[model samples]
Target: MSLATTKTSKIDRLAELTAKKETSSGASLWREAFRRLRGSKMAIIGAIVIAAFVVVAIVGPWLAPYAPTAQTWRGEVFANQGRFVGARGENLFGLDHLGRDMFSRMLVGARQTLLVGVVSMLIGLVLGALVGVVSGAAATLGGRAGQRLDDVVMRVTDIMLALPSLLLAVSVAAVLGQSLTTVMIAVGVVQIPIFARLLRGSMLAQGGKDYVLAARSLGIRKRRIVLTQIMPNSLSPVIVQATLSLATAIIEAAALSYLGLGNPDPAVPEWGVMLSQAQRFFDNAPMMSMYPAVAIIVTALGFTLLGEAMREALDPKLRG
Candidate 1:
């Protein structure tokens, strides 16, 4: 055979092999992560629990037997000079100080709590991601000017970190006035530093990887490289943080509400508001406090477990 023909045949064979290899390895990172998540028993259980909570939040008002704030003392036997009352059959969880059905209040409260949690977390996630991306990109791509910007952002983050999260939230809530919006803003503000720092660190690490270096050498635009390449690669940690911070945000919202810093109206059926009201009846009726507290705990646990499982699934080091 002629030398030119032999060379052409070899090149064609190599191209065929490369195509087969590329096709075989076509699964994206997200697809693999999802596959890993499906195999995680903890992730599945946590997902189930979270789904249940979401369903309850959506349909709870309709399922409730009575208006959350409606006063009804239909079937209660007074004891201890009318200080304590027997559980009414109509109100499975009994009644509060004003005779509102505890079960109804709890059901409605789920919607309020989840709304605050989800909304606040979204605010935090968006603001934090913006700050983190700017800071990370500046530090990675900017020269001395970028360094100064990064320093300023990190210093501000450090200041926020120095303050206790709940205290910061309470202060913000107090300043904003007592309302659901105030509670959401307070919790979201407190969470900003956490997400900012996490994403910044992830982006910084990703910036130093081989792919990023190659992109830079190939004359890709800095913005394109950062947004399309680095940002996507660094988002696993942020996603995990978002899941975990959701639990924290819920607890913080409740705490702010408990402190009389959330939802000024006493008639609103919020978990935190319910707890605050239940405090006066702690001695006479403990069930009022028990119900809301359990809801908070279970909801937080579900998010936390799910976040941990996501971390394990996304992180190759943790994968067995």
Candidate 2:
């Protein structure tokens, strides 16, 4: 009846509406992601392409007619020795110098590439989130000590950003000496600055919000405030950064592998390694270069599309 009571009722009504809307079938995050994804034709196509690659990567061994590492004399052959030019009958993508099945190898290569990319990006996400949260929330709240640490972290980030990512991966991989694990670490390290900077911005924006201040005023532990209050609000941008970083990380891994700085064994199937091998046979076997190249491009484009769609979906201004 009174003005204050009416205002309280309205606030409660708004909260109920918001909760209902958020819980609706198409209004949840994943559903919203799918909805926004469908709105972009290119993103949808990219998703399909990426999904196909994943399926192929998973089932390729079964589908491949011959062993990827099998070596036969008589120079080389492909795809059960069919009329597909590089088919070679037994070699789907044709044979390398050692008569290995290019198609079979490529199938295995996709799995390795995806593994490196996803793993490296995951490492970056964890490290970057910690660093960014500490740099932003701590520096703002910790006073001079936090500020000093923040400055150091920012300088490191700047130095990292100034370095070419490929060059960094090459340098690190060169020192670590070419193993799949090392390749993942190298790519992940290169990606940390990207995540850190984005996260710091998100944290700083959320740090001074009313809820955060209220939590602080309630004598909540700094960790709780940072984790619960500031962190939640900062997550949107972090998610966006993560999606984009997956693409960058994949490229870095591929470059490292291509340079002979990944996968200690020459026999290991990796798209980059396949490309490296194909270079020598360019004149005789152009398709050798084409398939892997197209695969990498399509995969990268898919991540980019997905990232763009995520950004748009998460953007409040764009969503309405």
Model 1 lDDT on a 0 to 1 scale:
0.80
Error of 2 at 52 (Å): 1.7
Clashing pairs in 1: none
Off by over 4 Å in 2: 1-34, 73-85, 88-90
Computed on alpha carbons, the lDDT of every model, listed in order, comes to 0.80, 0.73
Q: 131-226 in candidate 1: lDDT tens per residue?
A: 989998999887799999999998897778777789899889889898899999999998887777777777777787788899999999999999
Off by over 4 Å in 1: 1-27, 74-88
Give a tens-digit lDDT track for model 2, residues 84-129: 2456464556666666677778887888888888899998889977
Clashes of 2: 14
TM-score of 1: 0.87
Best by TM-score: 1
